[model samples]
Target: MPKEIKNHICEEETFTGIYSKYSKSLHDFLYYKFGEYLDPNDKMQEAFIKLWENCKKVPPSSARAFLFKVAGNMMLNDIKHRKVVLRYIQTKPKEYTNESPEFIMEEAQFFDKYQKALSKLPEEQRITFLLSKADKKPHKEIAEMLGVTRRVVDSRVYNASLKLKAELEEFNKFYAKKPSKLL
Candidate 1:
C-alpha cells in the first residue's frame, strides 16, 4: 500500500495531497516570472488541468518539473505571439503629419462642424456638393454622375457651398484662396 502510494499519483487522495502541497508554489513561480497582465493564475490552473489529465502517466516525484515546464512553455508562446504583433506594427510606416498639436485640434473641431453642417444639407444638395468638392469633379461631370442637368447640379452645389461657408467659422477666410490655411 505504501509502495503503491509512492508510485501512483492517479489516486484521488494522492492527487489532492499533491495539489495542496504544490499549487501555491507553482502559482508563485509563474507569477514571479510573468506579471499579472499575462495572467499567471490562468497559466497555473492550465498546468494543473494538464497534470490532472495525465495523472496516471505522471509520478508524484516528477509532478513539479512537469507543471513548471508546461506553464513556462505556454508563457513563452504567449510572449512570442506578442513579439510577432509588435513586429507587424513596427513594419508599418507612421503617418507623419508635420502639423502642430494645436493645428490638428483646431482642424478636428472644424471637421466636426463641417460634418454637422453637411449633414443638415438636403440629400441631393449634399450628394452633388460631395461629388464636386471631394471628387474634384467639374460641374458637367457631377451632372453626368447624378443623372441631372448641368444647371441643376450647379444650383445644388452652389447652395450647399453657401450653407457650409455660413455654418463653418473661418471657412470663407481659409477656403476662398486655395485653402492656404486650415487644411
Candidate 2:
C-alpha cells in the first residue's frame, strides 16, 4: 500500500493524488487488454468518475482494486457492444466497387482463408500473436500485461507463427491449382 491509499479519496487533494498515482497504470492495463480498436482513455476516465461518485462506498485500502473492477466491467460491456456491431456489419450487404470481379473475388477468398486460419488458432496463441504483431507491443510489455513470463510470450508467438504458416501454405497451394488471372 502506498501513502496515497491512506488518504480519504472523497477529499479533493486526496482524489487528485489517487488519480495521479493510478491513472497511468489503469490506462495501460485497459489499452493492453482491449488493443487498438477501443480508446482506453475514455474507459479510464469513466472508471475514475465512477470512483468519485461512489467515494462514500469505497474505502481507502480497497480503492485500487475497486477502480480496476469498475474499469474491467466497463470494458466487458464495451466488448459486448462491439461484438453486436460487428455481427450487424457482417450481415449487411457489401457495397459495389469499380474493381474487377476477379480481383474482388480473389481478395474476398484470401480474406476468408486468412480469417479462418486465424480463427483456428488457439485463443492464447492468437491473442499473443495479435498483441505482438498487430499492436506491435514488445514481449516484455506483453508479458507484464498478461501476467506471464517473457519466455511464455515468446513461445506463444513462435507457436502461433508456425501454425499460421502451415495454414497459409495450404491455402496458397489450393489457390495455385485454380486458374485465376490474379495469380
TM-score for candidate 2 = 0.46
- In candidate 1, what are the lDDT values of residues 11-128, reduced to their tens digit? 8788888889988998898888887878888898899899999997887888989999999898889899999998998896877877799977877777677778889999999999
Would you estimate the TM-scores of all the predictions?
0.46, 0.46
Clashes by residue pair, model 1: none
How many clashes does each candidate structure show, in the order listed?
0, 0
Each model's RMSD to truth, in Å? 9.4, 18.8
Off by over 4 Å in 2: 1-6, 92-183
Each model's C-alpha lDDT? 0.83, 0.83
Query: Which runs of model 1 end up more than 4 angstroms from their true locations?
Result: 1-7, 93-183
